[model samples]
Target: MKRRKRKRYVSTDIRKSENGATFLSILITFVIVMITLPLLVYLLTYVQPVKHNNELSVNQFFIFLRNDVLTSEQVYTDDDNKMYFLLPTDEVAHIEQYQNVIRRQVNGRGHEIYLRDIDSFTLQPISFGTQVTIVTKEGREYEKKIAHYE
Candidate 1:
C-alpha cells in the first residue's frame, strides 16, 4: 500500500491587508481635508455675522414690544435693564440685557439672546410712551419710538 502526501494550505496575511486599508483611509481623509480647507476659509472670510448694531437692535425691540404690549394688561420697564410684560398669547415675556447680550425670556422659560456687544441700553420717554435706544461701542446710536395702549 502507497501512502498519499497531504498538501499544506497557507492563510492570507491579515496584517499587510489591514495596514493597507488603514493607510488608504487616512490618506483619503487627509486629501479631503486639504481640498476643503481653503474653500472653508474663503467662505468664512466672506461670511460676516449679522452685526449687533444699534439701529437693528432698536428696530427689533420695537417690533417685539408692539407685538407684546398690543394685548398686554400691564407693562413695566427698568430703564436700561429690562422690560417685562404679558404677551397676546397670555405668556409673560421679558427683554433685558445679560452682560453684553440682549436676551428675551418668556413664561419664566428659556433665555433667548438676540443682539450682542451692546455698550448701553436705555428706555427714553416719548410722545405716547417710551422709546428704546441702544448704543454700541462704536458710538453709533439707534432709537425707535413706541406706543402704549390703555
Candidate 2:
C-alpha cells in the first residue's frame, strides 16, 4: 500500500487586505465629514434665535393689562405713572414703572416685572378708563386706551 502526500495551498496575506479596507473606510469618513462640515458651520453662523425687544414686551404688557382690567371691579390711575386694579377677590394690584422697568405688586407686596427698557410711562385719565403711553429707551412709543366695563 502506497501513502499519498497532500499539497498545502497558501492563502493571500491578511494584513494586505485589511490595509486596503482600512484606507477605503478612512477616505469615506473624510468625504462625509468634509461634506457636512460646511453645512453645520452655515447653520451655526446664520441661524439665530428670535430677538426680544421692548416693543414686544410692551404689547404683551398691554394684553395682560387689558385682561386684568376686563376682569377687575375697578381700574384707576394715580398722579404718577401708576395704575391700580381692584380685583374681584378684593386684592389690589398696582402697576407702575420703577427705574427702567414696569412692575406689578399685589397688595403692595411682591415685586413682579411686567415690562422693561422704559424711558417714560404715562397714564392719562379718560372718560371711562385711562390712556396708557410708554416710551422705550430705544425711542419707540406705544399708546393704548383701555376702558373698563361697569
Quick one: best TM-score, which candidate?
Answer: 2
Model 1: colliding residue pairs:
none
- For residue 144, model 1's alpha carbon misses the true position, in angstroms, by 1.4
Which runs in model 1 stand beyond 4 Å of their true positions?
1-58, 88-90, 125-127
Best by lDDT: 2
All candidates: CA RMSD (Å): 12.7, 9.6
Tens-digit lDDT string for candidate 1 (1-150)? 999987674765565444345777889999999999999999899887876555666577668667767768777787456777866678888888788778889887898887777888777666677777788777788776668777
Query: Candidate 2's residue-wise lDDT over 116-149, tens digit each?
Result: 8889999999988889999999888999999888
Model 1, CA-based lDDT: 0.76
The C-alpha lDDT values of all candidates are 0.76, 0.89
Residue 111 lDDT (model 2)? 92
Whole-model alpha-carbon lDDT for candidate 2: 0.89
Q: Which stretches of candidate 2 lie over 4 Å from their true place?
A: 1-52
